[model samples]
Target: MTLSVRSRPSALAMVSALVLSLAACGGTTKESVRTQAPAPAASGAASASANPDAPIKEGLKLAFLPKQINNPYETIVDEAGIEAAKEFKAEAKEVGPSDASASSQVSYINTLAQQGQDAILIAANDPNAVCGPLRQARSKGIKVVAYDSDTSKDCRDIFINQASSEDVGRSQVRLLSELIGGEGEIAILSATANATNQNTWIEFMQDELKKPEHAKMKLVKIAYGDDDDQKSFQQTQGLLQAYPNLKGIISPTTVGVSAAARYISGSKYKGKVTLTGLGTPNQMRKFVKDGTVSKFALWNPKDLGYLASYAAAALVSGQISGGEGEKFTAGKLGERTIGAGGEIILGPPFTFDKSNIDEYDF
Candidate 1:
């Protein structure tokens, strides 16, 4: 199946536009300025001499370190990355902690670094928790690419983001609003509090809720499930118990969303509480058919992984440095550009409902 891909405005451009709009409205508050600033640029370690004409190196070793080894969403991503590795004849492997925790990835990163891998791809569980090890990896001339969840800019060479962070975050709120008929107490069931991508999206979700169009929606709570199945289910139960009047829930993590749906599906909140967020089609199809969830959004994990693998290959092959305006070809996905902060966005997310859920299997 073909998917539509679109480029997003650069972070600097988006921040500049937002600052100008805020200034015009006489609301250029310090808080707004701080919140609107773009993240620091990627470390200069990736600025090695570029050779855009160089071919992907053969027999190079690449390792994918996801937040959790058992996460189905991340499994789809890493598997695709591995497939992309085969296209260039590179050896690729996936390794990570079973539990998604802040420091769980550091040891794995240290191990990869010691093993002298050419490239290390990771979906950071916490932005700062993995920084020291990532820095050490880069110091050893190993390329680092962060995907799905990002690490701090200085920690990685480039980030393969699934979509625009703001769009992903704001779109969740928009979908949840539509599902609940625009208003009532809604809580967010998120992944670990330290998850970089989750927090970034949640910030945008909060910002979206402030718009006049979403004024009626009151965010009652933000609950953390730590991305565990049982924990997310219990969190869902706690949310309903704490706020009996809750009308909707937005769960932007695959694990959290599916668990939340399972909980709501068997509880009294089934038809009453609207549920929406990012989820895999296979995991959410049953919920949509049973009327437990109305809509949700996500980019294809396979494409995300494929792009990240190719990006890592390009970096390792010195095809392009992780600098703004650099470009490289991702096997089947075509050309991808490196944007500000060394981010490569896959595309805008697609919303799935009963109508199109069947079209996707991952």
Candidate 2:
């Protein structure tokens, strides 16, 4: 569920004031938007007064840092984001750690804040590890956006999450339960141990699985792949080897889900064991076609990226803040509202199957 913060259109007046100030200045230049500290004039000259509330223009050197540098998911998301951000005349650049690490991210965050980025969007590798540096950057007048995974509450201006925690969590277990006949040993192939979304969904799934409504279903184990394909493959192999009677495996990460399909498709467990999780339609299309993967769920990865970019642009344009019920346009997704806890849910989980598999390329 998403919430929209009730905000009057007063901020639009702020935008108008910014434009009016530029009009009063005869010709608007970069200097017109910059807030300056009052300094004494050299020699025997009079000091100039300051205009501290001048609003900056929208052409910002905005950047996004993913958890891992070379992943297809992040790349796809960033590509969509770039296209959306271009409409607002903002530059969107993608940067991140070579590996998913808090220290590397901290270094880059400090560097960007020091070099003067207007805003930075990042998916935290560790929940609270980089909050100190992010908050420090915000204190320096550089904005911060927490996407994918959020940081500390005070560290980010807003968080753009794909969907609510319970929606993703309950849907995955329900999908797995249906394919496995609602009663069989199932293991979860989740992201890193520190991933908040993965953990949140897993917890909800566990709770949902015990509701007597799904009494026959049983959760056996949970494995961490750190979102590595090879590691996920090994974990799936281990799960199969460890439990000869295992009926299903749910992989929450895109890498983990894809790897599980590849493994089961080649292994002796093909057709007998079900795999369900978050995966791209393009990547898992073949598996779904051949029945290796009966069903898996995901939001449009491109749209998620697209929405994040628009949200960044809105924040920089002063369209919205960390308030509740603030609605913004996200192009093809139409109006998106900032829900409770400051999350903007694009929509609910979408399940893919043979009937609709060919309809979507992403």
Candidate 3:
């Protein structure tokens, strides 16, 4: 069921029948009779009633708010979401702060709410800092969808997770262990300290390192780059200087990984220290070709945004109400089911290296 870039369009034909079949099911159809009472609204669940048969509303206004406007990875994700809006005849636009600070996005959230957007897709920089504004938006009947990064469970209707948090965290540790021969001092160059996604993944990496197989590996320090290029470059230098015996480094953010690679490429640590984490193919290609990096991993950013857009539309159209076991068609990505905690995982991440890096464009 893994999707490659070339195979996504072909899946539409295969899933079209499934969509029709689900719509025709007697008991599940919107027009069917029901004996059970409608479920009470959970803390973060959508308040709107479900209408599974309702067609996607046209000319709906959707707004995407990322952590910052300049991050290339977020740019790709937001662009894909905007494209998806076009497919369903919705008007979508991207807006956000220039800096990824804890409260930088507050003003934008307030503005989007005031503008009466039907839905707002956000990647929260700080989970709690934006909770108040998110609540205000939800009070206005705006559908809130968190993607890439997340807010607390009670703050959003749905979270479009790129992959399982546990899988992403543990995989980074395993990849680094294999590269550094299973033993030595290592460090994590992360994004902001309060970033929900980064902190969650780092916690899993720490838990994975406690296993007996990784006993020889020591995670000495975790330095925050705040997702800034110059800061990440400096932090990489600091990590190497602070732990001269460091064998590897893992940076789970795209900005941090690329910055770390640039620093390692021209420094003495290029061949001695191994670097691995989540990164886009195009951004890491030059480093991989020059032998500065051996391997890294990430899911398709375009698909992440595309799926998020559809999920938001489903919420607005009342196709589902952010409840567990609810299902909706994500256009070409096919039918997606909501899991516990209002989460929809895109899929497992794909690893990249010199062997197959050339095969991907983003």
Question: How much is 199 displaced in model 1, in angstroms?
Answer: 0.3
Please give the distance, in angstroms, between residue 345's alpha carbon in candidate 3 and its true position after superposition.
0.2
Question: What lDDT tens digits, residue by residue, belong to model 1 across residues 1-362?
Answer: 22222233353243223211110001111111111222234643345467788999998788999999999889888998988899999888899999998999999998887777888899999999999988877876788999999999988889998888988888888888888788999999999999999999999999999999999999999999998999999999999999999999999999999999999999999899998888988889999999999888877787888899999999888887798878899886778888888998887777778766665566
lDDT against the true structure, each candidate: 0.83, 0.72, 0.84
Which numbered prediction scores highest in TM-score against the true structure?
3
Q: How many backbone clashes does candidate 2 have?
A: 7
Q: State each model's C-alpha RMSD to the native.
A: 11.2, 11.6, 8.0
Report the C-alpha displacement of residue 43, candidate 3, in angstroms.
5.5
Best by lDDT: 3
* Pairs of colliding residues, candidate 1: none
Worst window of 10 by summed lDDT in candidate 1: 20-29
